[model samples]
Target chain A: MLKKHNILVVEDELELAKSTLAYLTENGFSPFHAKDLKSARKLLKQENFSAVLLDLGLPDGDGMALIKEIKNAKNEIGLIIVSAKDALDKKIEGLELGADDYLTKPYFFPELNARLKSVIRRLNLEVNQEIILNEITLLPEQMRTLIHGEELELTAKEFGLLLYFVSNQNRVISKTTLGEFMSSNYADYGFTDDMVYTHIKNLKKKLSGSGCDDYIKNVYGVGYKFTVA
Target chain B: MKLLTKTSLNFISASVLFFLVGSMAMYFSVRNIMAEDLRNRLLQQQNEFIYTAQQNKVMDLVSELVFVQTTQNKQLYSFSDTVLITNEKYMLYRKLDFSYAQNEQDYKVSILLSQSESDKLIMKIAIMNIGFAMLFFLIMFFVNRHSIKSALGVFYSTIRKLEDFEVTQSSTLSLDTAEIEEVKKLNQVFEKMSAQIRKDFISQKEYTENVSHELQTPLAIISSKADELMQADNLSKEQMEQLALLLETTNRLSKINQALIFLTKIDNRFYTEGSTFSLNDLIKEKLSLFKDAIQDKNIKLKLDLLDITHVYMNPYLAETLIINLIKNAIFHNKSGGVLRITLSNNTLSIANSGGSLSFSEKDIFKRFTRSSENKKSLGIGLSIVQRICDLYSFNIAYSYADEHQFKINFKK
Candidate 1:
């Protein structure tokens, strides 16, 4: 079994923290909630968390200031900023400041969860560079992906996308986030979700044709998820 | 007419009227003065000559007599009158006749006094008067024009500043170059107005950000709680239905808020970064993303991608426009329908097989206005697409000819 990740949520609102904790706990991860930066700092000292869900607005101070301290204290922690709507500049700034990913506020917890996994996966701080799920095996260094012991022919982009999904499996990844990962430049093109969908389709078609069972799941009006269903 | 032209024309007309009145006064007064002086000098000379003639009646017999004429009895007084002295010159002179008793005999003496010198002097005065009036007119005209130009410069500078005003630039108007008091006052008013607009604009942007930030907490809580409720086991049928309705309502509210915020950001000119990329690749990628939906619906996709089209735009907005268009087509289409996308040159056209829309093409781009076929739509997708097209000045045309068609023509 894969190790269940520990998630720390730093939010000023009690209800939001509760929901975040509840969602994370339901997903089989240990969750710690902090209502302010002070508590978050204290929590960071007392325990280790796999990821931190940061909110920019806090009761005591700006949440952006805590990111530097969090990074300084723990380099392995995956930072995901959940901020207010239309604060795209701040989100980019957060990403530049070494936050793994960001989402605007009023976001679904599932989105937060997916992004947390994606960020952690992309960070690749672990020793296991090889990921195998079911009959699919992904060699990250070689940029090669195989299904059912047969080499699957994938374009460079398709290969990268497959590896991304293999690394962050069982999470509902939105087309927007997926597009950002695949092209590394289409995040600004809000319409690229269709492109992400197309790539996922091609990847799935190639995988299933090679005697691999269907593993990619679609969530209508949402996004796609890779799981051994 | 321009301010400068209008004022300059007025000055020209006023100067013309002034020259007309001034020339008449100057000509008459100068002529009168010159004529009076010449007449007085002629009359004094006549008196002196008469005195000399009276002193010696034989002066007429002497060679010094100006004119010596004897007439019987024609009583005509000496008077000065204007006469044509030459072809080009006129002269004023007095012709005199007096009785001179030469050796006690009755005789009529006539004396003619020529005033050619005075006539020349009067002609010079007239020329001087006309020359002075013309010189004054030209000087005043040029001075007035220069002053008007400077005054108009103030307004021109104001116009230039107004042209430079841009909300996205976030710079205030500086019309301190205006000089005229009234014009300066107008510039000051505009400066204050623009400053207020900039302030209001910034505050409005910040307010949206703050308000949306505050809204997210509650929205997150409600959605999360709804998701939790959805997973609850052993729920009654009615309760489950009610929970689903609640979740739907919450989701709808979130979508509306999100769309509103996005529209506000676009209007505020927030997305500034852009780059060039292969639009063909982006479109192909998006089509793949929608493959499953296409398969489930069994819709046939006809692609006529002729060339590798390049688009320079904010990638985020570009992607959004593509997805929204494709999604809208997919959402509104019937099962086993056709979706045709033709890309030729800078034109991209998307058409899908669907029932006739109840809404007119004009009203389709409006937010929250959905077709009768799709109740689940947020209806802001087309609005966002419209806005994106509008921002880039790309033409978007829609039609319903067998299939709902949307065509976008991008600049080459």
Candidate 2:
């Protein structure tokens, strides 16, 4: 049995925090919730968290105040700033204060999941060198993939889409979610439904042609799902 | 006209008018007084001549200035002007004529006085008056000009400060104190206005950020809830499709909101920090981000970098400007259409082989003016592009002949 990594979600809104906590728990993390900066600080002192999803606007104070404290206490802890203020200066400031990543609000859960996993994997490089799903093995550190112990050729974008799906398996990802993922991850402005479809088609073809089981499935003409079973 | 110039002109014109009128009045008054004195002396000399004639013979009283002549009838005393030629020079005289009887003989006596002496005195007085009055006016002209210039010192400084004032900056407008009441009042009004504007600007900025936070947090909640619902099993196809639609609409609304905030920030001149970089490298870098989309659409990209043009701009805005333009060209292009980009002589031209706009060409850059068929486009990309260009005063033009083209001139 694998040990569940502890995740801390610092958000002021109760409903948002509830949904995020539920999502994190379902994704195999031991999630804890804090509605304000004081409670978040108390929670941090009580538990050793593997990652933190910080909301910048807190009731008592700015979430930026806690960034330095959290970073100085531990370097291995993965911190991501989840802010509604998408200003460039704010993003730069958060990153400069040792935040592992920055995610604007109204983010897709799948995107968040992928980024959180990537941040953890990066922090614990030796422990998580590869992601193995049956015959398919993914070396995320090198952007390398193999099926039946043989190397698979994939483009950078194709690899990113596959990693996103693998990180969030057994759940339906809407076309809009996939489009936004492509747009935000690649910093591309105009990502259309057709582009996402084309990229997914190519990635699925490459995966199946390599004598690998078809894990990715199309769902109800609206979205795609990567079914592990 | 400048205030100083206008005031100085008025002062000069008034002094000239008053000086002219005063000199004329002084000259006439002096001449009148001299004429009256000459008349009074003439009367006194007539008395003297009559007394002398009574004592001696009337003919003996006749001298160089006095003349006696026998007359048939007695003439009442009268004064008249007479001209006499002496030493070949014309001389004007005021003469008094009277009739007298001496020892039963009737005689006419004439007494003459030269008027040239009083005329010379009047001229001297008139000249002296003009000289003194001119000196006084000249001194007053300089003093008036200097006083006005000094008083308006604070006013000119106020104008200069206004010219340099930028609402985006955080500094408050502070004006110098003035001795002049009108200028002091003007400065007070200006300072009050600037402070109000700053307050409004700050509140507006806060409002924009607040709106983003207020709307985005709810959107996040909705999206997260819908995503959570998607994990449920035993759901019908219709329910799943509806959930997908809900999530997509929520995402769309969030995007529109964020884009609007970005547009407002640009309008408010929020991005001010800048650096110089090469356009060629930036284009290549941004194009790589859209390579997959270009490949997916099978658009043939033609790049002609004739020069390594460098531009000084906010790097983030520069990136956005190029990305938005290229994305528009590629996104709007037909399948297998040619996307041509050429840069030279501080100009960039991006052309795409796409069908003509369904709407008016003039409306192409307007926000939310997309074709009915292409609902995926946010329609704010071109507007953002135009705004960034407008910020830097770059000339941007859109045209369509055989293909849709966007041209930008970096230099004005």
Candidate 3:
């Protein structure tokens, strides 16, 4: 069994901080909450966390400074900065200072989950992937995707998107979320929902053309759901 | 007021003085020249009179009698014991009326001359003085008027431009060529100053945008990692929910920052013009991009696009304006609401069904001004739209017709 990772969330807003703590616990991760840099630093000194989710604005000091201190301490902890300051310079500064990811406010919970998984994967979190679901064998690490014991050739975008859908199986994924996952430069690329339509269209066509039962179902006026039917 | 009045008074006084002095000098010189000529003629007349009387041989005693006579009236007097021989007396006698007749080269010369000629001489001197005074007055009037007209024109125009100047409107009151060199120089200075101010304004706007852009990546990392952490296994339900909310807030914060930075860029005029593109085509393309969002929100979009060819504008700015307008309509509108987008003759209008905006008509174009009711908005959307309109010289107007309506009239 893979040991669950621990995360430290530093946020000033009490309600928001509490909600984040709740969400982390429900998702099977232990989270330490801190309302300021001082408490966050104390938490850091006391226990080792797999990653730190730092908010840029803190009541005591800047969260950026905390990110720097963590990086400087030579701790192999992954950092993710949560800030209302979504300016390009702040983003670059946070990332340049060893933060693994950045997230803005008012984001969808599911998207946040997707981003969290990506970062964890980047950190090489140990997890068993050989799972048998009926006739399908899923091996996430080998990047081998199959249906009915036959390999399906999929584009890079298709593969990433499919994998994301598989991870969040049986849940409705919004097109906006799909676009975000498919695009590296989401803001600049103008990846609108139409682009999502085209990609999804291609993915569906390819899967069906490969003589595989279509698991991708469009939930009209919403998004798509990947499930074993 | 005092300074101007004094200077003008001095100028008038100096002109009057110059005229007076000049007329007086001319009058005196003319009088002296006339006196000398008259005296010389009278002396000659007196000598002729004596020579004629002597040659004709009147009584020797009588002929020898020296007489002094006034030339002005021809009154004679006998010098009982002395001869009248002084030039000064001859000059003084010429001042009186006198007459003399003599034959010179067969032409009888009758001369009646005085120190002052006829009354016409006085009138001529008066006329000459008056003419000179008038000439001086005209010169002064023209010079002063020219100086005043040029000065006041420049001053008033400068004030008008200052009053009417819009930051978006390039300074139209150019000092490139002025009638007065000094005014031209001043305008040049003003032009340089205004240019510098404009440059600084643009630079600061760009700096804000660039700074925001620089901040985006780190924010992405932080928010993404937080999100990832929220999804890991074996955590309490409360902790999981808390991480989830953190991730959501982070995402919204990141968007607001991005919007702010982009707004700054638009405000600073940091845009590039690409190839001429069809407004209709661009709008269609943008609408397609929002297809998912529109569908997801159940918003019905109706696009009334004209088959126009192209518009010469910064494509990026145009796109931004359109995107913001559409996005605003989408975000503020109720689910299943109607969104109408019309593009005709380069004019684009977007109307959407939504709650009444809490802002006044005036504040709609201002930056960071969200409706009082909606705190979640970054408030930079319409401001960005306004900026793009300004850059392209397009006309933008907003109206509230049960729903929010924004219209942009593009200029070629």
Candidate 4:
């Protein structure tokens, strides 16, 4: 059995932090809490955590700045930022700063748990291979995905999108960024946010219909995040 | 006339000075030359008189008589040949009787040396002619000054008008033919520049407004979500408490950002051409979207809307205007107050019962001008309304009675 992962939740609101800790603890993981950057740093110095849930708005300093510090101190540790900042640029910046995932505020707790697990699984991967989550197995090399031990058919673009999501796993992806990543000929193909939405809708239907648990959650006004609960 | 008068005065002064000196010099030179010639002639006559007196005494006597009569008196006289009085005071010559005397005897002369009274008469005549010439020069100077000054006045006023022209608040300044060709060219250039600048300013304003407006909805969602998350009970107590404050601050910042971007876009003229859509339909849709808020406020809405939905305008801007206006009414209205909205024949009017407007009718349309009591208000709603009207050539008017009234009349 994999060792129980240690997770640190850095936030300011006491009730929210306590509830988040309870949620993490109940999900078979040890969770720690810090109200500000100072306490978070103190906790980090004493313990090795598998992942850190960071909020960009902190009492002491910016959450994004702390994300950088965490990455610098430990390259292997997974970092997920929970922010209310929904701008495309901010999302892109957080991800680029070595965050394993980003979740906008007011998120459902199950979604957060799912994302954390996804990040942990990706970080633990030793070699490129098929990822097995519940009944769904995604083969990165073959660009094929299986649900309930049955090969699922996906369109070329749909396949590519699913693969990219699986590759990134827990991260919140913006449509603009995803559009660019999935196709080099987006302009020629007249790709738009609506098209991305359509593809995501279809991808979600296929996964669920094929007996695969729903892993894609819409982040409202931002984009989608693929993770396992 | 003013320019002409000024130029004429300058010309008159200069010409007067020139003519005064010129006429003086001319008169003096002419008088001197004439006097010298007269004196020389007189001397020559005197010498001739002596020569003839010696060579032909009878002819000399006749010449002397003629000279005396011409110089000394107006009266004519005759003398006898035997009267030879040659004192210094007078001269007598032989008198000539034309019928009986021989040719040598026919010439008779007399000389009278008398008073200088007659010399004044000759000098007076010369002075009169000089005076007439001076008067003529003065008249010519005044006439030229008057005409030239009038012409220059027209030219100067036109030039001044062109030089001090402003393009923002007014239409093109009228130009008359009195303006010189160069000035006319300058006026044309100014008109063209003003038109181009106006065009460019409008387009730039529109672009900024559109960009800012486009960015607002997404930002709002981000901020609201963030706030909700921070308030969620799922987080650890400490984490939840810390994030709540962060969320609030972020929410305020995002609101400011949205307002600023909206104001910037509105001011920059980022208006797109609107398609014909039912104003009534759009309003109904918008109201439905705000249904929850309307219910929360317990405000009664009275909409006397027409079936007409076709309005030629940028649908986005029109919708924005309506949203802001309705939102403003809802926020400002008294609890359980009536909100009235009426649309007819390209006119949209909204009125809500509430406290008197926080600003004068004029101040209401200026950006960032909120009611003094409502410090939290961003104060850009009415300005956005005004901007939409300006961009689409709509006429907007404000009035206050029992409640504030905003009326917008769209151009066909």
Candidate 5:
């Protein structure tokens, strides 16, 4: 059995922290929450965490200080700043202080999941980089995929969407979430619902044609769910 | 007229009028006093002639300047001016005629006094008066001009400093000290006003940032909660669709809030850091960002870069200016529409194939004015573009012939 990753969510907003913690738990990770910088510091000392989702604004102090603390420690812990401020300077400063990634507020859980997993993957270099679900094998680093021991061709955007789906499986992802993800990762283009629909259709066609079991299913005509069962 | 010139002119004109009237009065008064002395001398001479005629013969007393005339009737004393020819030159005299009774006979006695010396004295006095007045006026003109200029020194400096004052600058407005009461009061008022303005400006900036922070946290919470509810398997299709709508509405609201904050920042001149860069390269780079959208819409892009124009502006604003314009053009375009961009002679023209607006053309750049078909558009892009152009004094125009066209003139 694979060991679960320990994630720390540092947020001041109680409701937001509760939702984030629940989301983290549902994604197969052991999660801890700290509502302020003082408690966060205490939690950091008592536990071993693989990654931290740090909100820049905390009750006691700024989360930027925690970024430095985590980076300076002997153990490697992935740091991701989740800030309400979309200020460019703050983003640059967080990254410069050893944060692995940054996410603006009102973020999608799937988006956060992808960034957290990517950060953890980067920090643990010896961990296997391939994601496998039965007949499907995805080599994320090389952007290559295989089904039943046969190479499958996918475009860059298709490969990105597949990776996003695999990371966030069995959950209904809304079209708005998918659209935001597509626009942010791709050229910041206005990704319409039709465009997202087309890309998913093409990706689904390619996956089924390669003799792989269909994993992606539409949920109530509102969203798509990548079911692995 | 300048204040100094105005004051100096007034002083000079007043002095001239006073000098003219004073010299004339001095001349008349001096002539009267000299004529009175001459009349007294002539009277004393007439008294001496009457005594001489009483003692001796009255005709003998009339020599060169004296004259005795025999008259049938006695005359009262009188003085008259007479001219005599001596050595063929006319000489003026003051003569007094009086009647005298000597040796039981009536005699008319006349005494003459030369008036040339007194006339010469009056001329000297008039010349002296004028000379002294002119000198006094010249001195007063210089002193008056210098005093006024010195008094207004603080006022001029205040004006110069005000001309260079920018609210974005972090320095306080400090004015020079003044001896003049009015100028001192004026400086105090100005200093107080500037301080108030700075305080208001700083508070306004903080309010904008605080609003963004305060609202975004709740939005984040709401969105997360809705996203969680959507994850439930027991929800019906109607519930799921409603959840989706709620999420999209939250997202839209957040976008509108952010756009308003950004507009306020631009209006407040927040992005003042500047650099010089090539517009052509910037357009090309931004176009690459929209390449997928263009392909999705099947937009036929026609780009003509006739020159490498280097524009000096805040790099962030420049990027926004180009992005907003390009986004507006692409998003409003129809399927299989032609998107044409041309840059030449310090001008940029972006045209897209779209039908004429259902609304008024003048309202195109107004905020929140969008077509009925594209309800998804935020409608603030063109407004932001117009604001940035206005900040730099660039001329922006929108026109429609066969397509919607936006042209910008970058020349000052």
Candidate 6:
């Protein structure tokens, strides 16, 4: 069994903090919530967390301060900023201050989950060297993907989507979430739903063409889910 | 009418009227005085004749030029003026009729003297006054016109300066002095009002931006909490439906927030101008990106492309504009509908074979005009397209003739 990573969520709003904690728990992670920057730092000192979801605005201080604090720690903790839409500059600033990734407010839980996994992987990857999802296998450190002993001709966008979906198994993902993930990699204008659908189509076609059974299931009005069942 | 032209016209007419009325009054008074003097001189000639012929009996020196004898009893004298022919020229004659006892004899005397010279002098005065009046009119007209033109020059210079003032380039409007007082007042008022408008605009933009930023925290909470509630098991169908609706609403609210932020950024000049980009390439790329969606709807696209369609604009905005236009076209289209795109020099047009538009074409570019059955659209896409086109001074027009068409004429 995979060891569940612990995450610390720093948010001022009680409802948002509760929702985030609930989501983390549902996804099988041990989660802690702090309503302000002071408690967040205190929690960091008392126990170890795999990642810190930092909201930029807090009651006593800006969540932005936590990025620098986390960076200076002896064992570095992954920092993921959760900011409002207009805080584009602060997002960049936080990243420069040794934060690993950031998510805009109103972000989906699946999207957050995907980002958390990504950030934690970069900070400290899992001990298991290989990931197996039925016929497909992904070696994160090698950046190589294979299916049924055949090499995949995957574009950079396709490979990134495959990796995120594989890592976040059984999670429903919206078009906005996928587009944002792709744009983060390319640093281009965030894509539209149509583009996301196109990439997903290409990804599904390539995977299925390689003698793999159907894995990506559309959730009708909700979004698409990547699950074997 | 221009102020100068109007005032100059009024001035010319007023001066001309004054000169005419003045000259006419002078002419009548001078003529009346001249006629009275002629009558007085004629009466004096009659008295001198009586003194010479009757009192001194100096009949040898009496001249017969203006004298006539008449036999009439108790005659009284009367004087009148008449015109006479003298050397084929019209002359004035003042005639006097009298019966007087001269040398103790009853004689009726009729005397005449020429008043033609005084009449000619009056005529000359009338001619001089008319000529002088015309000269005065001409001089005053030119003076009035020159002063008006110079005053108008000041007005136009101030107006031209005002016209040249762009809000982005200049913080304050400066005006040259105006000789016209009313124009000066106009300038002062405009300067004050424009400055206030600029100030108010900045404040309003700042407030909107701040509100938009502040809404994000609460909105995120609402959305995430709603999503969490949706994942709970054993929920009724009604609960699930309500949650789904709530999520959709939250997503729309978020889109509106983003749209407003985009507006504030554009207004704040966050995107700097100038970059050469291939518009053709962007359009083609966006079309390809939408291929899957279009295929899902079974839509066919007809393309007419030029060899090159390069344009000068911010590349990011250009891409966004194209994407919005294509997205709007695909989203509103009918299944198996035909989408036609034409790209040429400085022009690009998109036509989609959708049924009649739900709203008027004029309202299509306005914010929040949802003209289709698609619930996923926020109705802000076309307005954003219009705004981006407006920022670049590109003329975009929408029309529906068997198919809905949006055409943009780029400024080269």
Index of the highest-lDDT prediction = 2
Candidate 6: give the clashing pairs: none
Positional deviation of residue B28's Cα in model 5 after best superposition, in angstroms: 5.6
For candidate 6, write residues B252-366 as lDDT tens digits.
6887888868866676655666698788888888787776567777889898887577888876678778888887888788889988989987789999988897777689888
Better of 1 and 3 by TM-score: 1
Rank candidates, DockQ, best first: 2, 5, 6, 1, 3, 4
**Model 6 C-alpha RMSD to native:** 6.6
Candidate 5 lDDT, B123-184, residue by residue in tens: 88888888888888889889888888888999999999889888888998999998999999
Give each model a TM-score: 0.72, 0.88, 0.49, 0.36, 0.85, 0.69
lDDT of 3 at B382: 84
Error of 4 at B2 (Å): 23
Superior candidate under lDDT, 4 versus 6: 6
lDDT of 4 by residue, A1-229 (tens): 5578999999876666776786677667899999999999999999999999997777787888787789899877889988754444567899998898887554445456656866776786733557776787777546687888899998766776776666555545545445434433222122345557877898999988887778887754445667655
lDDT of 4 by residue, B157-248 (tens): 66677677643433656656555565567657755776787677667755554454344434434433543454333556456445444443
Of the two candidates 2 and 3, the one with more favorable TM-score, higher being better, is 2
> Count of backbone clashes for each model?
18, 0, 82, 56, 0, 0
Candidate with the larger TM-score of 1 and 2 = 2
Find the 10 residues in a row with the least total lDDT in model 4 chain B: B92-101
| Model 3: CA > 4 A from native | A125-144, A147-150, A169-229, B1-97, B100-265, B268-386, B389-412
Error of 1 at B172 (Å): 5.3
Q: Which parts of model 6 have CA positions greater than 4 angstroms off?
A: A1-14, A17-82, A86-103, A113-144, A155-157, A170-229, B2-12, B55-203, B226-249, B260-282, B295-298, B306-320, B344-347, B356-373, B383-398, B408-412
- Runs off by more than 4 Å, candidate 2: B35-120, B149-156, B177-186, B304-310, B344-346
- lDDT (Cα, 0-100) at A5 in candidate 5: 92
Give candidate 1 misplaced runs (Cα > 4 Å): A1-4, A109-229, B1-12, B41-123, B130-163, B169-192, B236-245, B272-355, B389-412
Candidate numbers, best TM-score first, in rank order: 2, 5, 1, 6, 3, 4
State the C-alpha lDDT per candidate: 0.75, 0.91, 0.67, 0.66, 0.89, 0.77
Per-residue error for B144 in candidate 3, Å, reads 16
